[model samples]
Target: MKITGDHQLIKKINKYLVLDTIRRQFPISRADISARTGLNKATVSALVNELIESSFASETGLGESSGGRKPVMLLFNERAGFAIGVDLGVNYMLAMITDLSGAVVKKKRIDIAELEAGALTDKLKKTIRGLMPHVPASPYGVIGIGIGVPGLVDDQGSVLSAPNLGWTDVPLQSILAEEFGVDVVIDNEANAGALGEKEFGAGRDVSNLLYISVGMGIGAGIILNDTLYRGFSGFSGEVGHMALAQDGPLCGCGNRGCWETFASEKALLVNARAAYDDAADADAAAPNLDTLLSLARQGDPEARRLFADTGRWLGTGIANLVNVFNPELIVIGNRMSLASAWIGEAVYETLDSRSLAFHRSRASVAYSQLGHSSAALGAASMAIQRFFSTMKATWE
Candidate 1:
């Protein structure tokens, strides 16, 4: 026996297909959409009409014709809606607004030395509230808010644990939704970085890759077969907590010898401060990542060596991942990327020597192209994705 379906489901599916086709290949004609989607011309036309009527698609001038009247070109109205994305770091908050096409319209960064949950939430609310008015009066206004936190985010958007930030069991999504009266999405920052690169940066062409976010801490975003692979518990990308040394520096996760303990921005600063103090420079200002980076840029041997040491540690972890995953590419992102100039050689050197010959040869590592905006833009993309999902012609 065969099953029958209602027209609503079919209509929703078909309309989504048409919209997706146009979104991907804009300046597209309805005739081409009909051919590509295997839907008849009339169905394609009807769907296109729906999208245009809903302000999702708009007609441009005529296109080149094939033995008939010039077909009108259709354009996806990216500016019809706007989305807000936030990248909440251990010490900073990066927020931005983007069109549906993921082009950033505005961005701001605020630094917070401490991560008290109340203060953090208040700041988050304020940042988003400030951004809402700048949304350019689109059809959906500020459609939704997407946040990337450096922690384990469950399906319900509760941040289970972010040790570095001292956060746990925070219902971030619900809190934001209730406060702002809009949809909210929260995910691991590394995962957001991976999505950012896949959608707009270096990893766009690769299906299997890893995004390593080396910031105040470290994490990995695994993309397998063009999909973000959140593990069985949505905690897959906590690569920073991976044990590297049997006895090394204590990590924020209360573990010794974790990869981030050696390779993260926090580690770099710790080492920098210690080294400076050892030199008996009591009058020296606290050395931060930016100071060390500037010193390295100015050819300070000590600063460069510090970065090299960190790079070597980063490479060791990456090599392990390369052997295990054999991904097509590995994108090193986040704060560590800022030191790529100083650390590039050491990372390459370690990977070359340590990683399995086959895996190392197959996989290539590079820094984030979007720099600090990777997670923020990616979060925005998630909000944009949800906006479209909720508007898929679900009619009565």
Candidate 2:
């Protein structure tokens, strides 16, 4: 059909409505899609045919019919394309390749001591290249790459500052895009984590949610009314640097008593190290988080106390979030969530005491459903979203 103007817009909208309905309710029949989307049967059929021809959908056998001929069911072709997602942490990098449906087809994690921008970029390139060999050929093979970084990322995907990695004003997105010859997206790790949870994890059914990433540092991804609330300049959700204590410990962000300085995995480790240093066997090597968790599990009083203290601090920060945002759900993610047993109690206790009664009563705190994979998966999901949006525009 030679569509134009308002008719073309309507056709495009109806096409995507049918596609989305099939994606969500597949294996759904054309009649079902038409009914769900309120589009005419002929329009739904035409869109489905186009999607199938474009490899974005498929006929998935027959479904039960309400009398009359058996209806052919339609399914979204999740394997039509792939996306790469990378989560760059201070001490580690996680990379994954996901299909259009956000299923991780392959993934890898690499630990690194290097923090120089060049070194990190090289490492990322190498990792992505390794995954490329495994990507199956499709209509849009490796549509794009999305990266989640532990730093302040501007709209142009520049890392303005990442104190933990000593990176500043690095054009990470452009660098990767140039290397791979594909679109590249970069955002704060917490924001990616929030998107991950909202689309595929704990916050799947909740519109208003908070994803708190408590790792070497703390950051939050705010979801208000089912959308990521990136402020102007895309530098929102740097809640870790929010000052909580005027005379508290120094933070890497050149701030005193930042929330992360008290509630982060770094704080937990510091407290654990302090406890071990004061022990009778002071010569023992400082314990890592896993070691501390083992000690806490084995009923080490000092280790348990440290986790509880960290949890209390975490709760204080969460209380502030609850009062301010009143999110329906708050997801506590990253490495610290592994020690939920020791930390959860103190978190609840502190939150109960600190948060406003109304807000505290409404907001339920939970651990990340995707655990350590949230950021990486979120990046892949974002890439997939971008790809579909572009595809919809082309149809329009």
Candidate 3:
């Protein structure tokens, strides 16, 4: 028993160190790995061999020689084990299969109406199973599944409430675990997107960054000091529902003039449609926002005006965020940023006019490079973190 325990402990410790080192600095040679991890050369070589055998890592040609023969470089196997990441939103369900490196191997998207948990969970289960074949078959199997939900999620992976989804206290994680037979993680979509950006996108280098997901609603993911800051109850970043106006439009969160009511896609579309209908000009005849943006792209005056107006409103919200968080970068995501060329300019203008001078100069608002995939990619990252943390725990 003692021998087996010691063997397992050492094995886990080696796997933990190897995976950790590779994650931070991949495409590294075995000798470099030894130096960084303080593992002896033979131990590093043995661990590298084990990782390669287990399909968790692979050789990536050779590195520049120091003194000895050109050493083979090692990297985390992006094609090794897979994880499923799902962004379940009010309008769509985006599912992606990713490898240990959080690179999307396959993606699936489905449009679904906002509904109760029972029906939604059923559909989600089918969607997840449908995506499994897309992930490359591997010995480790799909490590687990992570979900970026559109509402408040408790620490226990319960959907405390998803007003958009008409859910309250839904055990989404347990339901998914039961259906998929794997570990499940649930977090707010915006928070997940923030993690995605911080880990793999534009905010990677920033110590403080804010990811604002402007979809059907508004929410933010905040990274402070290079770590995700989930406030007490994991609800710290609920900035979208922050009241921006005392008597603004009625919000889904039972508030008036919430930030999202002014800045979200629904808000932009709503106001744009209103502006289009109210305009006495000839170009205001069209009421649809998508059509308006299309016309704006073609130089329609009314369309341009509508986008600019909405962009100003969005900028107001962003300015408030800037004042509060003082993040180094603010990433705008979701469908609205598609019109970044027009709206982005307007956002900059509003911020320039409204925010404190210091913040305006320090922070740059940019479109999300990950596009709509930020949430799913972030979910995959959660799985990767889980995998590494588990390995570390086993070692400890």
lDDT, candidate 3, 1-396, per-residue tens? 999988888878877788778877988988888888888999888877877886778888889998889988888877667889888888889999988878788898988874877888989999998998787878778888999998999988999977767789998888888888887889999999999988888798899999988888888899999999999777877888888799999988888988888777777678666676676763745555467669789998767776787788888988988998888999998777777877878899899999999987999888898988898899989977786676566543
Task: Report lDDT (CA) for all predictions.
Answer: 0.91, 0.90, 0.84
**Model number with the top lDDT:** 1
Q: What are the RMSD figures for all models against the true structure?
A: 1.7, 1.7, 2.9
Error of 2 at 388 (Å): 1.1
**Cα TM-score per model:** 0.97, 0.96, 0.90
lDDT score for residue 186 of model 1? 98
lDDT of 1 at 27: 94
- Worst 10-residue lDDT window for candidate 2 reads 281-290
Alpha-carbon deviation at 160 in model 1, angstroms: 0.8
Number of the candidate with higher lDDT, 2 or 3: 2
Query: How many clashes would you count in candidate 1?
Result: 0
Regions of model 2 farther than 4 Å from truth: 1-3
